[model samples]
Target chain A: MTPDAEQTGGIIEVRGLKTQFGDFVVHDGLDLTVREGEILGVVGGSGTGKSVLMRAIIGLKRPSAGEVTVFGQNFYEAGGEARLAIERRWGVLFQGGALFSSLTVAQNVMAPIREHLNVEGDLARDIAALKISMVGLAAEAGAKLPSELSGGMRKRAGLARALALDPELVFLDEPTAGLDPIGAARFDDLIVNLKESLGLTVFMVTHDLDTLHAACDRVAVLAEKRVIACGPLDEVRRADHPWIQEYFAGPRGRAALAAKAS
Target chain B: MADSPAYFDIDLDNGVLKLNAGGDWRARFLKAIDSRLRDFADDSVGRDLIIDMSKVEYLDTAGAMVLQRTFHACEQRSAASKFVGANEAQRSLLEQVEHHLAPCFVAPSRPNAFVAMLDRLGAGVSEAYFVAIAILSFIGEILVAIPRVLTRPARVRWTSTFHHMEEAGVDAMPIVGLMSFLIGAVIAFMGAKILQLFNAEILTVQLVGISVLREFGVLLAAILIAGRSGSAFTAQIGSMKIREEIDALRVLGLDPIEVLVLPRVFALVIMLPVLAFMSSMLGIIGGLIVAWTAMDIPPALFVSQFEEAIAMSNFWVGLIKAPFFAFVIAVIGCFQGMEVEGSAESLGQRTTLSVVQSLFLVILIDAFFAMFFLEIDF
Candidate 1:
């Protein structure tokens, strides 16, 4: 949709990824690539390892087997010093916001910048405020702790923190899950606006079909230990897979599609 | 450093300043650009402005913000401005940045010093009153539950009681013995020092026996157990409260007092007196050691003198206070735990308060017991 996306390049490439917990296997032979400057929505049923996939990609969970690279480097091989720079390049919004309970919202947003960058404190505070506002959190919310805010507000605060470093690639875990419909719609718009503005490569794991229709430029459906389909929404929806057919053709999916069409 | 990657130049174009922006204007490289833009925030560019981002390779949000602020000096003076030769992505980013000018940080202001002091004072007074009321009500609740428990012996959690008994009583034997032994030794030594001048150093046996049996033994045991187990009860119960386990018990039609509190109280009450007895015996032995070593008192003669000095009433006076101290400590600990609200900070505070309050109350009760025993001439 924009010139940034026109110069498409592979930003993250995962090949033959294998992840497991104890005896239970989660993902095996998983392969995916996130193109630069495009929102790639990962969709799957519950317990299908959608979140596990996101965690594996972000290096929070080490894959038992296979290669995962970001910015054309094998981050798994990159030691602590080399990995710090890569870690700084991407931001993640956890499933539950995962904000520091003791720190106020603004301080939470400023943490990464203060830790990783050498910017002045006041300026970092300013950047944090800007990011908080950009995520549509109220100014008053900056002083409140995470426990004081509702789930929706906490999610917005988390988004602010995730955006604090002005990261090029962002991973959102169910960004619109707990929000009300209006708030969810606004969040989708915010994602689209952010994509247009920042040219960010978004790796979003979501169950919200509306988000896929509104914000995501492409969709990757994960199932059976791998991404069964990955392409534009329409193309993936037309895939011969039974799960994809049920997913996009279900009543709720039809409603979301209808909403987008109008 | 040799190459100018992200840089800008300003020039006057028909009374309108024109900005030439270049290089990869990303967040990583925006610090220099941002610092450069501050010079223009305070300057007076006395005309309209145009930001030429045509030559910019990449423009992220931070870069857009810096570039847009470069001409903010002119824009503030009602000088019209627009982006010239900018791409769609750059324009959107600039618009977003413009919409969100960094707000000034205002720390939450504190109240006046005097007002804050008064606030704290008032809170302390009310909190003290609340604690008094809470403790009283908690005691009443236990009193009410006791009759019900007595009626049904099966209601007592034998498993939990035995567990707490091991935790508070049997396992505490070595420490109690050691503590009393040292106290006994010190008393004997002190007794010999003062009485030696009067040619009555042999009175040290009477001193060790009477003091250990009447006061030191039970007092030492109570205080040690108060610190060790009272804080633990608060922490355990307070975390349970935080996790809503207490509420869950209530919802399931089980009284929390019956389930959690009574087992601990019963365990401690039964165990404290037994510990006190052990402490008394150990203390006498410690006193005997000192007496034997320093004054050359044989074990046989020391035991005979000890029997003559410490009457059964002296041991009874110390032992009688054990159950009371145990009951109070257990009640206070569980009460403070139940008082805990949701935060980790609150749980920590309640645990500290539980230990402090139990220790203070135990000592206070000991003073009252001492007065009562003296009145009765026991």
Candidate 2:
């Protein structure tokens, strides 16, 4: 599929993408379109190629086949500066938060801004401090390094870093992986609030069923080396595929459904 | 998941044995033993009776021993028993246990040798390749850093550099000072002894100053740092890489080379010369102490003579090599640290490589400097 054909008011359009590691294929002819101002959740079992697909879209891992267009620009076709510019237009929240342990929470948030954006000195610090506070972390927490923060707090700090550039598009990889139920739910609420306030296009890879139910506009199930099901919650739940049926009908799935109902 | 045994039963009455096979050979053997014991209890037949053992599968020396012991007991009762199911493998195992038992056991065929050799060769090659990969990773790190010296300027992390130097230099001063003083004293004593033989004991100052400034000072300083600071850098960065902080930097659009590596390289480049100069002065002072006491040379006369003997060129040569040595240590340290993958084992391996490589490069570079200066008329 061509890059232009996939672009349809979507911040990211991945078409016929394939990623392989030696003989093992992670993504095979996968197509996905994440629209503007919507949280699109990519869900799959472990080793279902969810993270690889995300990495490919973000230009971290090069795909064996197909195109990824972000913000109407062909990601692979662009040169270094051009690609960097495209990257600046979007932020990534890596799995495990991936915070710089060496830098304080405030500095970690300020990194991208200082690198890509040309803000200087005290102004940069102020912007960083503000972003940290925006993510529900206190100004005092800004002085602490990532090692000092709790898991949920680290994720929040990572989210703050992602939001630093005021990017129209954001990608979160397993954002609620290790948090407790209450923490995960609170994170989901925070994500929803951020998306609504910033008018963001979110492409999130997650296993948290509650987050999918509460925050996602569309849930995409990756199976059979492709997105086998993609639609709103009700449509996806009705999918005839065995994996999807079992996945959403399982104990965890029921718990999430029950939580939503409550 | 229930813990249940599946097998046959064996009963023994008095001296008579009765065998009953179970679900499988292993289980059947267990049941057979039980049946034999029940039979021995119920019957008054002699314990020495021949029993068939041909139904057993994959027997070994242990199984044979069980049968052998039963046979021995039967013999004591004036009865004899033969094992009917002894396979060649079982016979071989029996023979292996005791050479004297070979006459009582059967034998098995041996496998081909070429296949075994081929398997061993393949395993050896793979292990060799793993080690080669590790070495290549170290080389790859150095290659990666060379480009950083030019392309990625921001990787020169000055903040970390100052922090490291404070630890590497300031914290290191006492030991370096003490060691340099001792080294100078030894040199002074050695020089005085040699000069006294020639009745030119006053030349001890010249010998001490020249040796300290020309080679000992810079080399000693570098060796100390390589053991202390260089290893520390490798461990710190290696641990960070293992923990994914480096990856975090890249994802955040920060170049690790600029942010982490550059400052270290910059700091070493700045600090090593100062360290070398200090080391040289300290080493000379140490030599002066011994020269004064051992040779009966006055402290004032020794100082003047030592200062006269050491040219500006001697000091410059030692000082100049400091920065280069520092660069070698820093680059090797950071490069090896960055090369670390996965675990603490990689950290250790890289740390050793850093020290060895840095020392080798330092000495090699020092040799070249020595040769270059030797060619000059200064």
Top-TM-score structure, candidate number? 1
Q: Tell me candidate 1's interface RMSD.
A: 2.3
DockQ for every model comes to 0.38, 0.01
Off by over 4 Å in 1: A1-9, A20-29, A43-50, A207-214, A217-262, B1-39, B43-47, B52-58, B69-73, B76-79, B102-106, B112-114, B154-160, B166-216, B283-298, B374-376
Residue B293 in candidate 1 has what lDDT? Answer: 88
Q: Write the per-residue lDDT of candidate 2 for residues B145-241, one digit (tens) a residue.
A: 6585657555455567689778888777777777777888898888777788999988878887888888888888888888888888899899999
Compose the digit string of candidate 1's lDDT tens values, residues B147-206: 999899999888998999999889888998899999999999999999999998778888
TM-scores of the candidates in the order shown: 0.84, 0.45
- The 10 consecutive residues of candidate 2 chain B with the worst lDDT sum are B99-108
- Which regions of candidate 2 are displaced past 4 Å? A1-7, B1-378
Native-referenced TM-scores of chain A, all candidate models: 0.95, 0.95
